[model samples]
Target: WLRGTRKDPPTLDETIAHENKRQQLEKKPINMLPTSYGRDAAQGGTGKCSA
Candidate 1:
């Protein structure tokens, strides 16, 4: 159960779900931030925002 040996991080769906839940719990608009930058993005693995 070590950090390196553990499973990969949550999928995009899970991340989005968690973000949505957090937003709802706080009762405020969640100012979205980029999940990654440059060529190392994780936003669906596209690494670029598309509107």
Candidate 2:
């Protein structure tokens, strides 16, 4: 019969699981860089600093 031959699509739970797995695999780490001014404020081996 048509009904028996047709396959059902993924359910809500299956969809959520697939999405979660995809997100986990596509995750990336953040890269940070300090500004030049920030580096200057650190002082060049002066050992004196102010916040």
Candidate 3:
């Protein structure tokens, strides 16, 4: 089923799971970048790599 088409609020577990999944997906690209920018600000340089 489509997530947005649901009528009822998600359960606590479902909500948390969805949040975790979203966070993971959001972080994956940064973590996958060929740099330590995800862990260190200094190493990230100008931080315009992704821009």
Candidate 4:
């Protein structure tokens, strides 16, 4: 098996900071709106037609 180049492991402080950031992101509310696709003029998307 071919092994890729490995990087140094994160320090204690770095690991703690990463975990804290992950937790903060996990608690954040995901506010996303549905989008429209295709050439349908009625549906909202790129208003103008493509060449």
Clashes (candidate 1): 0
Clashing pairs in 2: none
Instruction: Quantify all predictions' global Cα lDDT against the true fold.
Output: 0.43, 0.42, 0.49, 0.41
lDDT of 3 by residue, 3-50 (tens): 445678768877676567546645765446644544434543223322
Question: Candidate 4, residues 1-51: lDDT per residue as tens digits?
Answer: 011253656668766765675456446565522232223334322232211
State the lDDT of candidate 1 residue by residue for 1-51, as single tens digits.
113454888678866866675455346335633332312332333322221
What TM-score would every model get versus the actual structure?
0.40, 0.41, 0.43, 0.44
TM-score-better candidate, 1 vs 3: 3
- What is the C-alpha lDDT profile of model 2 across 1-51, one tens digit per residue? 013353886578766765565455345333424454345435531222111
How high a TM-score does candidate 1 get? 0.40
Those runs of model 1 whose alpha carbons end farther than 4 Å from true positions after fitting are 1-6, 28-51
Checking candidate 3 for backbone clashes, the offending pairs are none
- Give the lowest summed-lDDT range of ten residues in model 2: 42-51
Error of 1 at 8 (Å): 1.5
Q: Give me the runs in candidate 4 sitting further than 4 Å from their true place.
A: 1-6, 32-51
Better of 1 and 2 by TM-score: 2
The count of residue-pair clashes in candidate 4 stands at 0
Output the lDDT of residue 50, model 1. 20
**What TM-score does model 3 achieve against the real structure?**
0.43
